[model samples]
Target chain A: MVLQILFIAIALAGVALFSYNLKKVIRNIRIGKAANRTDQPQKRMMTMVKVALGQTKMFFRPIPAFLHLIVYAGFVIINIEVLEIMIDGIFGTHRVFGGLGALYNFLIASFEILALGVWLGCAIFLVRRNIIKLKRFSGVEMTSWPRSDANYILITEILLMTAFLLMNAADAKLQAMGAAHYTAVGSFPVSQFLMNLLPNTEGALIAIERGCWWFHIIGIFGFLNYLPYSKHFHIMFAFPNTYFSNLEPKGEFSNMQSVTNEVKAMLDTSFTPPEPDGSKFGAKDVNDLTWVNLMNAYTCTECGRCTSVCPANITGKLLSPRKIMMDTRDRLEEVGKNIDKTGNGFDDGKSLIDTYISREEIWACTSCNACTQACPINIDPLAIITELRRYAVMEESQAPASINTMLGNIENNGAPWKYSPADRLNWAKES
Target chain B: MSEQLNFEVPTMAELLAKGEEPEILFWVGCAGSYDERAQKTTRDICKILHHVGMKYAVLGTEESCTGDPAKRAGNEFLFQMQAMTNIEVLNAYNIKKIVTGCPHCFNTIKNEYPGLGGTYEVIHHTQLIQDLINDGKLKAEGGESFKGKKITYHDPCYLGRGNGVYEAPRKALEVLDAQLVEMKRCKSNGLCCGAGGAQMFKEPEKGNKDINIERIEEALETQPEVIAASCPFCMTMLRDGVKLKDQDQNVQVLDIAEITARANGL
Candidate 1:
């Protein structure tokens, strides 16, 4: 019955991984199309490979990068151990190729080494996120963490990996008494020394080894299936998302979606902007934003580089580009839960200025490209901002009275100043 | 706004009847036309123009805002319209060469307007002064005019970051025998004067700290007596900031044009 259950569990885990990865791939395809990536296909592909395989931008802090590198390496190589466990669990055998086989013993030993490495890296990651105030983790307006999900995710990974390591140490003692020289299990000095205290030796040690293997396999599978619902979703999202990053030049504007006849029918006949009592032309909520932009709010790593370099934020203005991404993130998570239940998000279509972001925030941007440039991830807050401005100016006619007055004068006078066009070269003539 | 400051520049009739590469079309700019003190530099530059025997033309009451303010304030329509008019005026004159005292006008004509098809060979007057000094057409008169005063330059966006022209103004000041102090942020990262986007022509925004105010404070940190600048807008904003911050008790805002021209004794 135990063997039967193990096979069923392993089969279920494989199906879950396949399904989740496929869904993630589909979403990435949509994002790549939406960004209108027209750059050289080869260059983008090369960048994706380097960033994905290398975690290049992850090294902004070398410590985190170094720590993550060990775990990442272990995660890739330890797949052999997982496959061995799955085979052993399904067939009720200690080793499919026999414990005497060199390859099988090597893999078992390799996984123990990796488990130790992963434990060390995960402990540092937990400490860095928790005990230290990195400025990246400090929530604005609140002293405590605003989003607890990543914190919880980290804690859970730490607990599970630590327990898995303990399980390995326990197994190493049990395995060393047996004939198989599972490199780590047989060679570990402390475990080998500990194994001598047991009198019943052979039979009892084999039973202990078998039980520990089951625990290790189950813990790993549980973590794998739980990943899509956790903050570790970045593992799946980051690579493709990096590849599909907004390829539009820093200077070019994202073109407005052409209002189709279908969209016209969706609107009221008056063409007046949606009021508090009516649906807005702007996003009344998160659903109104472009889908990939909505994805960005969730995918944000919450690095404060955008806030640090914002021209508006620097000039003592209230607009924090980091906060802008955070705000959308908070809203989407809130509304996303509701959408799953009731099929609703931003139904009112109110402008972003009116509903989500304030008008004072909208006018504060210097269009300096500093915020977009500073962001480690390719989240273009400025592009989203200017798109909102384009809608307000051209479609909704909701630009601030001050900015519009300048626009009006320029529209009328050919210069923001009240000078005559014929006198353009007046300064050039020496009087 | 001061209508009394207009001047009569002797137009070079001979330069207009020229080959493709003429010597110079001295762009006096609105500030030079209106500010009485700025005229000192205007006259000195004109003398430099005359010294080279370079036939130079003037646009006499034909110059206006280069729409630098318009583009800065997100007023693209006004900027483009000005571009077209400027192109028409230049085409009519058959003018091929240019020099200007206004960095705003220099940036607009050379960078912004050309992108809209009003391309011209534009240079700031300080640049031309530096070039003339190099060619021995202009003299490096040191002691008397500068009077051992320390100077710090406020780089206007239109001149510095807008076009990456940093060296000429510093060279002009150095040659004219003034000490140069670097502001905390200068050149590419130079702060705005609370005035780039037509803000120079208008009242201040409700910023927690005015941009010009912040910039002036950084310049004051250098403890220079004179805040020398190359652009009219920077002159206006930095001067206002100095006054607002009460640093005018120790500092004075002067243009490179005024400084170089006074030192040159033109």
Candidate 2:
């Protein structure tokens, strides 16, 4: 009864903290401008299934993709065992679904195999990050915290899987000893090999099994709470990120409606422009960006696939797409904290422009869609860069000198060059 | 030096005044209009049109910039200004079908113009050429035969990845008797020619190497006699890269339209 009470309290607290963090994240994402991503529900659902569920894009890098698949599959399939654990924890029962006979045995056997897969997969990932030091994981933005966070998640997953296997091993030993409530219900293909290492005494075996059960459940609850603070948040956000991603032709940038209204008034004198809403021309900070962009920043897993493919970054430019996302999320977090303190809105006097992302970084982008194409979860760093550029050009009226000259020529002349409109047909007269 | 072919190119205004409408509008983008090297490509496209007996007319002086560079430069106000004016001229002509030699113009007219109440069927020159080949209107039998020569097709950013058009340009090449070689980065994975997104108008932000040089190295790896390009921006960039490598004597950079016109004896 005491064990059941402790289990219930820990489970409830874990869920409560996770819900609180999730709500905070959703609120931060909602602080940006509204966007219409709700159109085409069926298409969005299909994208979520293919990208998040099917894991199609990850196959671009075959080796890491295969390892990731094992970890992902193990995480999903092992959750069924977690469901059984939940029921057993709540009722103080041992192997409550063990009554399903052969089916339960099959499920346990497969889960044991998957736990081993997860262990192996995570161990390799740790070596790749720490020992081999993949270039993608060592960008300037990685710093100490992001690197440590990745290591922590991997280590925690391995520890949890270890506890799960050991729990099963102790339970198997107890079953063979003909102990009450042990019930000889599981078929442990992998864990059976582990049973010989466990102590043979009943009291020692029961203590090991119960200790592992408590440790496994508590570790999961801790992991659930750790997600929102780490890059691992992608596990939950990837579905919505892929679903809300841009579905139009990648080259087609969205038109500014505010600019359109003002242009119409300028071109046609009889046209009546709507009353000025006093909104800025383009994004000055997170508040000016669309909600989807904010969500994209939060959804970034810091994989650096986008940065790896960027032409600017490839040529040693200051721009890194991964850093852009990290900056956006960091700025959004600052804005969220300011709102919390003042209970109103952002007034930090520090915007996302010069304070976080630099002029050189945003300007270096080729506006190529390589980053968008390379992102496994479809996060668009180009959109954020363009938005910052828009703010610099339209609002501040500051652009590179050559770009200004080009715009002047387009305004006075019909073309980007100094040629006259009448000269447009001159090519036809040439041989 | 080549023989001068005499052909009459009609403008939309002239055709409409004569109580006639063209089957398609040839959107002569800025580069196609004024750039010296691109004018040669423009003439070849015209030659192909005349040979095929397709009724086409240009907007002539009435056609303005498509605002592709302006929009890409982050000046939405200037972009919309240019776009609205161009949309007005295109709408006035009641143009239903259009083809462009530049992928930038094709992408903007096809994708961006619709949001501003201007919608028309737009296609790149390569797509039209491919369709013409499929319909037996254009063939590579009468003109220059590339039987033993190797040629490579450089995918334009706005055409290949910008729009899903990997097959059309390759189809145009496949119709010729030449061997089509692919760069290490081709089609969907194509590298940019360093002239996209208004980069053509300005020097690139401090980098170790220019994007065009990077792409040119990849193209040169295939070791083809001719590098076939579709976009005028790409044509200029590729030609510059070939010149920089001093391979202009050994290698030739030709537009797809120019190549097709030579193949069909236009």
Candidate 1's TM-score on the B chain = 0.84
- Candidate 2 residue pairs that clash: none
Mind giving the per-residue lDDT tens digits that candidate 1 earns over A116-172? 677778777667667775655553522344446566655655555555444455556
TM-score of 2: 0.97
Q: Candidate 1, TM-score vs. the true structure? A: 0.65
True contacts kept of each: 0.15, 0.71
Model 2 / residue B52 / CA error / Å: 0.8
lDDT by residue (B1-266, candidate 1, tens digit) is 12222334455343444433345778776556555445545665666576556667666555545655544444344455555666667767766678987766786676555544466787888788788778877665632467567889887766665566778888878876667889876765566665553455544435677777777889999999899977766777788889998888899888776666556554
RMSD of 1: 8.2
**Weakest 10 consecutive residues of candidate 1 chain A by summed lDDT:** A255-264
Q: Which model scores highest in DockQ?
A: 2
